[model samples]
Target chain A: MQSLVIVAHGSHLNPESSAPTYDHADTIRATGAFDEVRTGFWKEEPHFREVLRTVEGDEIYVVPLFVSEGYFTEQVIPRELRLAGWDVSEWDSDGLSADQATLVAEDIDREVHYCGPVGTHRAMTDVIVRRAESVTDDPDVGEGFGLAVVGHGTERNENSAKAIEYHADRIAERDRFDEVKALYMDEDPEVDDLPEHFESDDVVLVPLFIADGYHTQEDIPEDVGLCEDHTEGYDVPETVDGTRIWYAGAVGTEPLMADVVLERAADAGADLGTALDDVRETTRVATGD
Target chain B: MAEPTSDATDEGEASGDAPETDPEAPEIDLPADAFDAVLDALDDRDPGEPLRFEGFSVERDDEGEYVLADGDSSTPLDERDLHEELSERAPAVTDWYAFERVVGEFGPRRAFLRWIEDADGETVATRYAALAEGIERAWGELKITATVTDRGERRYDVRHADDAGVPVDELEAHEDPLDARKLVTYDEKGRYRPLKTAPSLAGGWVFPDLGPRDLYETVETIYPATVANWHREREGGLDVTHWRETMERQSGIYGVVKTWDRGEGHEHVNWVAEACCDDSQCLKRREWEYDDETDLDVDGGDGAFPCREPCSVVVSAARKWTRLESEQPRTYEFDLTPSEKEQVEAIIDAVADGRIDEIREADTKEGANRYRTRFLRAKLFDDEGNLGGVPTEPDEE
Candidate 1:
């Protein structure tokens, strides 16, 4: 009976902005894994706060459907979930117990747990590399060509770009491509400078966003000078300092994204013994009449 | 209930699946009013019903228009009050607002005057004061008002040059005439008056039509490049279907963008050039095209021009857009008193639903004409989850 809440970044302008999360929820619901699974977006209705009120589950688990572990995951989600009130510092073990007792004594004891983002799983590399390869047309062989993993880095948290770097390093270790580098929209070694920094004549830029939006279309293209004529398919064939810089599609909407969500859910369940039972108990308590 | 296997059964199965999973249980029952009618109409649904209706519920024809049991006993659904109640309560949540804005704003002005039907041309003179206040608000503090009505349709309105009722020459000479007269207005004595002069601006909102499918399709055809550009940017694949539908709906209600031929007395085929630029970086026009060999310059070079220009001009390297041609100009201009914009927005919203034909005539009888020809209709469903047709048509009124 543990209800699953999938939090997505929705937009008032585009209905498709929330499509992937909705589709994932539908697919997960079809499996009959959880009693209730619902979606809410930051920008769209049934907003994040409203999403919390939607389900009657004693044990609620939140899974953020975001591309990076940025401000939304750390600040916005926690602020909206009302879980921050009970959350003591990580080192405050005694405070944790005090909070737990307060929860237990209350008429409705709600114990909430959050799972990691879909982008964190080690298996996500497969989807990324595949999407990169699918959009890349560079025939240059071996290790000479460069792979640039572009992410929407923020100034809020210095460590926000770690996820993008981790994926980049993972791909670099494989050594299939000559050099792999992590670039960002906001910070140093910017997306536009990839062509000059790499030794290879060909550079493949992949956007690590959940959706293709303003950054991918306007900012990225303006920075890297993507060919305005080439429409459909995420290949950028613009010349930078006489080098061919190619652009890859955003990673969020990959067909394998559904598999990644399932994988993350499974991984989160591994630590909790009798997870289904835990869900059932939590739901029963949460829905107390 | 045993799960059936066909499409109809699948739909029913899906609904039942959600209810079954929940612990709560309810015994389904046929209402006394719907019992015999449901049985009789089991196979006699209208041809237009299935194509245009989705996520709508049908109840007793509340307009009391339909004949039931040989016209012996029929009760009206009171759709007027129902619509009024809905418009008052949940106007924003409903998906039908898209069409409502489109059909309602299909007139002389791209903007629609609140809920009024067939009031075009000279009729606009009646709403001069109301429109003046709206213009003041929209234009950002102008002291303008309608004065001379020579042809009745044509208006000669003037705005005070300054907040102190000064003429244009008295204000800063460098400022553009239009910019200097931001939403300011004048009273009957030609004295400058702010919001205190006219409270009509405080009232209802005005709207523009989004248009029907045909217009949307044309605009889409014209702006395929822009559509593709938007599609390329989303993580979820760009909803080409929805985009096309949006454009068609916009075009139908807003009409087409073309020039008129004074000699031929017909709308001439023309293409509108849109300059897309990001002001954050430099204004470098990205894409540009021309359909005709006319000497058109898009760039209004230097000291502040509108984001869009009515005439062709050169653009910077950052601006990206293309030219699209149409068979003829479908444009028209009509003036609304003031509240038309809000009504137009509602009408456009209704038209965008893509389920216009399903709206029942009974449900929208009061606002049917204004709602119909220009606006599109969509059906609403009951809590029990039944298909209800649209309750009104524009032509009916």
Candidate 2:
């Protein structure tokens, strides 16, 4: 039997942090692809340390539903998953880093294929572009609107901004949008500086986050002037400082993300078998099939 | 237990003596694979030896076919057909897979279900019927009810114990177990529940249908590792980090917790445990004491689950108290009447026991009542909110 374990950062304060992970797990489970689809959390129950006990399969595929290949994906996940020699303490004095590549460890009882996080996958670029296009009604919205990919960056890890910059550069190379810029929540070119960074009057801000938690729902909307009241939801195409801001939901919530997770699993050499087509047939909207 | 067996015996007598050879034997609807797994497990044991687990015993008869009996039964052994006996004795035994799953898994779910079955102290058939009728168990402040679904699968419902009688429609229903995290973050009074195991969980919400795994996950979300720790302690495997060891591991801003261990015979640790680890303060029974060697005077509480170590709330509060304890001793003199001194002590006791909320404003007879407290304040306290017109600190002049 084969299994897929989606690991995400759950929150003690907010329920929304783990919503997307559960949604994707449900969608994936409905396809009947893997024998089992389970979820683990860093801050919640069935913690990463004991998540493996829930899996009954000998061949397991673990996909981190995080937005970046930073501290969690690189160190904490591997350490907690007990992936062979990746058992070094997260706060180790030696400062050694776990391998960030698609890792497959057979040292444990099962063959655990630890895939790269879904947010860092190449398919996430399509998810970001789709999110930006989704908020507007224009058939050719990208031609005139600037796209700002908002990421929760940190000064502690430079790799936190890599996925956002990679997606931004990739989208910029496509030349479909007038401009594409990468923005961060902590680093330079913060989410609040979206207006100053974009040349287009109408700009779209797409949060490259794994969940519609405090960052996507409150912080990004308030920073872009879309949310006047913190308790209320925001509308798209809201005017912020004379610039029309079109805000999209977090990229991770997109239905296409289910496909991205499978892609990450496939990249890590998970045997999708014949069920892979069923998953794409049910979840993929971009294919227009 | 006697009631179900009597009922089964009545059904058998109603069917007559040739019940084994009766053409209309009740269908044995046990899951094929799960029964085989049970058979496989039994096969591992000695040939004639019965495998006993959670109020049920399974073994093979002389014909080499499987025979299951209630471990609690005192009846004589008979080589009856498995189908007729099972259908007559335990009609609710369709979902053997659920039993297999719970017994096969080596974790909290298995331990919890086994505990539930053993606690019932009934025959397997009677327990199955009770589960079908929805038997409720209390885990901390949560009410967990396990019911056999129409498909012969076990479905668990979890809600606050206070909301046990409330209809499902009256409460918010959750599908995912992770939603319990948000439910446990605050109390009904909208106060943040700093300790997850505190008995302040908000009610009017229920996860009315969960699988065994999801039920375990939901309970864990609400109370973290209480079940696992409880089970571990029962099995003599709980790695308890006592107050001293836990405090010594504190670093950075919380490093002051280590200073609390002044070798004063752990009297201060007893105070910390008394203030934080009580049944009223936390739902987990305090298993950790001053150290592995010394035990505290305060009771560990009658909680269903055990706390393996000092929680973050205890550590954080201990740090604050440590800093306060380091201050130089000072003496302040105040004169009060006998009743006033007793009233002050009553006020402190009321606050410490979290009974201030129970003291009604209209019940002015109570010493801690708002009107009585106000009357005392008016008669004694000065305008600076000082007790008995005495300043805590001496004037600079």
Each model's DockQ score: 0.01, 0.14
Compose the digit string of candidate 1's lDDT tens values, residues A67-127: 6554565556655555545333421322111111111211123655655566756666765
User: What CAPRI grade goes to candidate 1?
Assistant: incorrect
Q: Local error of candidate 1 at A39, Å?
A: 0.9
Question: How close is every model to the real structure, measured as TM-score?
Answer: 0.38, 0.68
lDDT of each: 0.42, 0.71
CAPRI verdict (incorrect, acceptable, medium, high) for model 2: incorrect
User: Positional deviation of B241 in candidate 2, in angstroms?
Assistant: 4.2
In model 1, the runs with Cα more than 4 Å from the true position are A30-32, A56-59, A84-109, A136-145, A154-156, A228-244, A270-289, B1-397
**Cα lDDT for residue A44, candidate 1:** 51
Best by TM-score: 2
